[model samples]
Target: MFLRVLGLLICFHVSIVSATELLVEKQAFSIDNFATFNGNVIEEVTVGWESYGELNEEKSNAILITHYFSGTSHAAGKYSPDDPQPGYWDAIIGPGKAIDTNKFFVISSDTLINAGVHDPNVITTGPASINPATGKPYGLNFPVVTIRDFVNVQKALVESLGISKLHAVIGPSMGSMQAIEWATAYPDWVERMVSVIGMAQTDAWTTLALEHWALPIRLDPDWNNGNYYGSTPPLQGLTHSLMLITQQALYPDFINQIQPQHSPLEQAPLNDINASHSAVQWLHVAAAQRATIMDANHILYLVRACQLFLAGHSGSLEEGLSKVKAKSLFLPASSDLLLMPYMARLAHDTLARLGKSTQYAEINGIQGHLDGVYQVQQQAEKIKQFLEN
Candidate 1:
């Protein structure tokens, strides 16, 4: 019943966007049922997104790029040149690059996690934001949102654009979860998929790692069961969480090579001007904590959804794989301990058994999970070859 209403809204929104200009724009729409995986529903769903390139007459030449955690919809390059920070995948989505904006229409959206209060770039309406009705941040009151809910919102956005199908759906890390979900829920919509450095399910070890990341923010006294919006937040907790995440995401060799010799965070660096405390740390605890506090509940919800992921737990891995008729590309970082390359192998093997011709590539880079993001140039070449073939 809820899906029925949401479908109608999507049809209406697509009509509105189709009549307007192409390029990039931001808009809001309604999700009638908002059914979450935990059997909860949001009466009204709000999503923020940005787009690149032009939509074709048939709207079939569409590519969806889902982002990792701590990421926004700003993909390829910035909306304007004067912007302070560049887009996340500026290396690949340019004029003539792979997944070129000159050809395919690319869309990326901000997820439900709102980030923190101090961060100005993140425009999220999460737990720390506010409940329009009560005039306070939802905090603990924000219902738990699953990966399915996140994908459902994105599906609504795409459908609203008259894009009934995709040339490909590509994503890394958490974004891969959304790509996989789309394949399962609406298999007919995607023509091809690329999932990098992610798995069909979060293993127990991965769950433990995420719990550690969440622990620090929750421990802060200012967290106050997520009610400390107007007050000073728990800076220490947020920092600890970031540090833990940093340790997990980065390779030990990369850290060792940079720390003592060139980094400001190294214990030996003190007198040199370039060796200042702020030099090497692109991420600070204060910023991380605020981001965590601002989107604490949303983070919890996303993490929980990731935990619920198992290719076939909702049905069967084989069943889910069968739905994906799209010729798939599964690329997992060779050194990725978190997602692990073997998981991709499992999916590849299953798809093969189901008589689906699939391709698997293990990225041979020491950058760990960062390999998926940093080595886009190499990945893009591989992608170009795949798409061209």
Candidate 2:
């Protein structure tokens, strides 16, 4: 009986060790002076990143995973097993998983102006970061950045690790833009690319949608022209902006099903003024909950950056796409209205017309644009096949 108990203890210990391995830790890399696509420069910049799996002797097995607009570098692990949430793409990245850790060394990084700069898990130089020149948070002084700037920083981070070439560069949404940028900016550095729910440039509709996201923040009195740091933030504006994003990020059907079925005119008892007895009220509450943790400036900066996203910043789309030499995979969410599937289809069509090696698939899920992250399993097999090829 004692021997059996010892065996059980050993098994339990091993389980503990395995769970610990999946917990993500943040790491930072710095550049002396990082130049922006706009010709401005940050005297010193720091980028936060996380890595999973091993870098083999050949160093040819590296994969770069880019994060979405609201995501961090913690792509595929837990902070702890007891933590409520795993990394955003935990579903598709791990040993024996779609982007198998055993065979590939995966790297992900927080983009400049990443959403949660104040969060312990993230580190980025944004409006919230101190200016080495002034020793105060940059606030509105932070130079505007573009998608190309994001790619430039990632290039520095990759090369710093002694990695000369990436086996693949993959991402969903904003990350997809970065992946495409990598292939276009340095075709020789990337071997394969996976662009999910992404486009070569922001469409007219997307640009208009992004304008709405920034309008609220600009109108908020507390915003004070983006200098509201260390004081009252633009909570109302931020929450409203997030509400707009949440409403659009998920499918209408999915949200309608989750929303309580109740008459819009129904009012709570006078004594219970705080009760959310309607769908709109519930949505507001949810948005507020998410907004409270996010930085308004970060979102504003990222939104503008996304609006300015052009695969070929200074050239025509066809000219930029014509430079891509990496084998590409394009996955569009079937129900996405935010970054519509048509956008992905256009890119695929363009690449095919150029006679580029590419594959196209649609993620048929109810999650809208979010299906790229939430419904990754639907396309896991295809991704594995593409990477293996």
Candidate 3:
């Protein structure tokens, strides 16, 4: 959910910016009685998706781009010429960019509980969605979904389109976790995989760090045990959660450069105990903006999904990874503390030892985990080469 930090960069760079523009529209897909990992069923499920380029007659040229937390299927192009910017990965996903829409049909979709519930462009089913059975928002009654469940829905969508296999499955952060799961869950269906700032499993330390993202939302009085629907939503709790997430996702160096003194230009915090530092104030503004469009329960559900991540949902990571048939590329950011580079490294090494086809690289940047998405252009050439042969 932390991948949205790209907007904070003074200059966003990609391998190449295509001369021509890409225009796209959002679409929807639905599933019936989608079962959850814990044996519950979501009677009906729907998600938003958009794509670039064309699907070849053989359907062998299709590529799937799973989104990170707080992201959607709008992976490239603008819905209208008036848009402020193209999709998140526009740099490497256009006509002549790394993913190359010219040759491959690229598609991305929103996850089951995407955080962009308030964004007009996104359609997702989460706790806030209506429960057909009860005639009320599902709230906490929504079945707990896993990365595996997310993949299963995507698989159903792909099959509905008459595609037997994916040319590749690419994602960043939580997206990476899904990509890895795709490789293992249906080895024959996925031919290639690209995981940026990803790991094979969520360990104890990392899971605890993620739990902090959920704590604030749960502590809010308005949360009301996740049944706040049709009532006052947990705005304060969501804002604080976003604030904590933003702080944890970025690097100290990058933030220090933006606010070295951590104070307002005209005011000194020392003058009043009630005053908050500039960095804290900045977080307040940023987090408040994000919280307006985000749902507290959705964030809580996503945190649970992430914390429960284990590729293939198997007994062990090695056993799970051993099922992969896809040629894989691991691209962990050099400075990411959220999901350290070593996690990706360990996954890559495990695949190598298992005699699987795999490659590893690092994207260097100051955004820490955010770099996996914002600075991913650094590895565009490598991504292009890997996708080619």
TM-score of 3: 0.96
**Per-candidate RMSD vs. true structure?**
8.9, 7.8, 2.0
Better of 2 and 3 by lDDT: 3
lDDT tens string, model 1, 98-131? 7777787888877765343334444455566557
Which candidate should be chosen as best, given lDDT against the real structure? 3
> Which candidate number has the best TM-score?
3
CA deviation > 4 Å runs, candidate 1: 1-33, 114-119, 262-294
The pairs that clash in candidate 2 are none
Off by over 4 Å in 2: 1-21, 268-277
State residue 288's C-alpha deviation in candidate 2, in Å.
Answer: 2.0
How displaced is residue 152 in candidate 3, in Å? 0.4
How many residue pairs clash per model? Answer: 7, 0, 1
Q: Over the stretch 226-315, how does candidate 2's per-residue lDDT look in tens digits?
A: 989889999899878877786777788766666547665566733476765677676677667667667899899999999998886867
Question: What's model 1's lDDT at 76?
Answer: 53
What is the model-wide C-alpha lDDT for candidate 1?
A: 0.66
Candidate 1: 10-residue stretch with minimal lDDT: 1-10
lDDT of each: 0.66, 0.82, 0.88
